[model samples]
Target: MTKDWLTTGETAKMLGVSRQHVVDLCTRGELTFSQPGTHRRIRSSEVQRLATSEFTREQEKSLWLHRALLGPLMLDPARVLQIATENIARWKPLQRGDGMATRYLEQWDEVIESGVDAVADVFTSKDERSSELRQNTPFAGVLDDDERRQVLQSFREHRQREHAAV
Candidate 1:
């Protein structure tokens, strides 16, 4: 069976922190870990939770934006659209005052309401076009291009793993 628990080093890598930090978190009971035969092992779920919780509000918003934009490509289209809609709604207020951003969100709302084909069209668009879409998104000003790319790549990898398990 695949191991579901991560060693301190592995957990540190996932959390982008040092091994000692992971140990400190475990010692402080901030992150759950178990000592099995003198080695501390953290559940992968705990690592994910910690990583997510560590994100700044802007990072979280960017994450949700990536999920909304890329999720339908790999998962149930309708479900992804619903998630995207909720994400957009949640961030809309914070995203006000930018005309391009407002227009982009409106476009997403229209596409989501237009049904599955519109969502698919977005997923199937050329890379250049997709990049353009990302540029116009609310997250564009929040996350730098490299950060956005990293977030999208990470989400894609996660979705691939999830699909492989299914």
Candidate 2:
């Protein structure tokens, strides 16, 4: 039988993020892990659940771009959350009949209320709910145009290099 737990590296590979990101998830209490000896061991089941929420290439690209907000989110979450809160309020009506999308938006509010760590989790999580909430993101103006442009350009360059290497 397959082992029921995974190493940080294994979890990262499954989530398409760095091992350190997996550690961060544990630190944020998003994923529970056991410390055996010196390494962190996460439940394989939890990792699989996250993996199942797989984003399309475009969604992954968007998420990668959003990683740029990690710093700002950590540094001044209050301002970032204020913008997101306003965005959510404004867009609620726009969602009209898209219940799933609206529900995600409401969830975003809860994540926002939960504080910085929770919001950060949403930005980095591979969970299906997180992915859905990302589509209805309330962070419309968190990043300035220059920061957004830089992140987009960097993502483009990275994708080009990835293709070239392949």
Candidate 3:
């Protein structure tokens, strides 16, 4: 059976540290553990949290940059366009790129002018054209497919609520 808790050695292996270090962490209460019988056990969740929490700022930055560079290649064009349009509409005036903001706003307007079918076309097409469109767009690469979809869905829901209140 799969275990929810890890033994001290298992936790050490997962964290890339020695068993003694894991023992020390458990002893110091830096890592929470349970003494079930004679052995110490660490919760798998706690190990995951500590591993993620221990990243340096530079490491985090490098990881995000790498994800951004790779993210767009995995996204659908329609989703990307919808995300871009929503983001542009919601962008604050104080943000950088006044000229670029106006241009993006104009593009958003044009997309709306073209109607839902044009947007639907983007969803249906899985061609190189769609990939090319995604590649040309800045900020499209910043979020991985799952993160982008979640953010876009959040924005879409927020916009629907705003429209409903009007």
Candidate 4:
């Protein structure tokens, strides 16, 4: 018996069984355990195994959605849409019948939802520097050569003055 042996209570709770049942499992060789003297202990991982439930449909759907849209939409949105549409068309109707198909549909839905929001979020979240400069800066395309030269000359003089001071 090792000191790390889980007590009967921990083992029972993990296996969703009574303390006696855990003892029985240990006795019957259905579950592996450790004992330190007369005391029993179950590993935390063993307990987690019994407590954890399989993923539900909604959870699977949400995960699929998040993963599908986790990349930039602009580079290949059409290809994305095409793949999504094809997969959805093939699987959406039979979603209840197959876990694999359900996953595909969920992923497509996630991609569309996330892609739209992501695009909007990125477009609206312009940095302060870009926003301020965009508003203040004149279009250089419209500037005559002389005007551009004057602006450049003024910038050079400003840089020289700052350097001299430094």
Best TM-score among the predictions, by candidate number: 2
Candidate 2 lDDT tens digits, 1-95: 14898899888888866566577668767678899798889999888765675445455766875688888888987888899999888888888
Error of 2 at 110 (Å): 1.3
Stretches of model 2 off by over 4 angstroms after superposition: 1-55
Return the top candidate by lDDT: 2
Query: Could you tell me how far off, in angstroms, the CA of residue 47 lies in candidate 4 after the best superposition?
Result: 2.5
> Could you tell me how far off, in angstroms, the CA of residue 99 lies in candidate 2 after the best superposition?
2.4
Clashes of each: 0, 0, 0, 8
Tens-digit lDDT track of model 3 for 1-166: 1488999889988877557657767876778999979999888998998787744232333333333434342455455556666665566354456453455455545653585555344323434333222322334444768876765566557557765896
- TM-score for each candidate, following the candidate numbering: 0.37, 0.63, 0.32, 0.26
Q: lDDT tens string, model 4, 1-166?
A: 3444567876665554456556655676645666767766777665565447332222232233323333523456656455645655664686565553355345445544576554323223343322222222212233347754665566557557765896
Answer with 2 or 4, whichever has the higher TM-score: 2
Segments in model 1 whose C-alpha atoms lie over 4 Å from true places: 1-75, 127-130, 136-166
Question: Per-residue CA lDDT of candidate 1, range 79-149, in tens?
Answer: 55666687678777776555545666787787768887765665445343343344344333333577567
Angstrom error at residue 140, model 2: 0.8
lDDT of 3: 0.56
Superior candidate under TM-score, 1 versus 4: 1
Model 4: residue 164 alpha-carbon error in angstroms: 83
Candidate 4 weakest lDDT stretch, 10 residues: 131-140
User: Between candidates 2 and 3, which one is better according to lDDT?
Assistant: 2
Residue 28 of model 2 has an lDDT of 68
Please give the distance, in angstroms, between residue 67's alpha carbon in candidate 1 and its true position after superposition: 12
Clashing pairs in 2: none
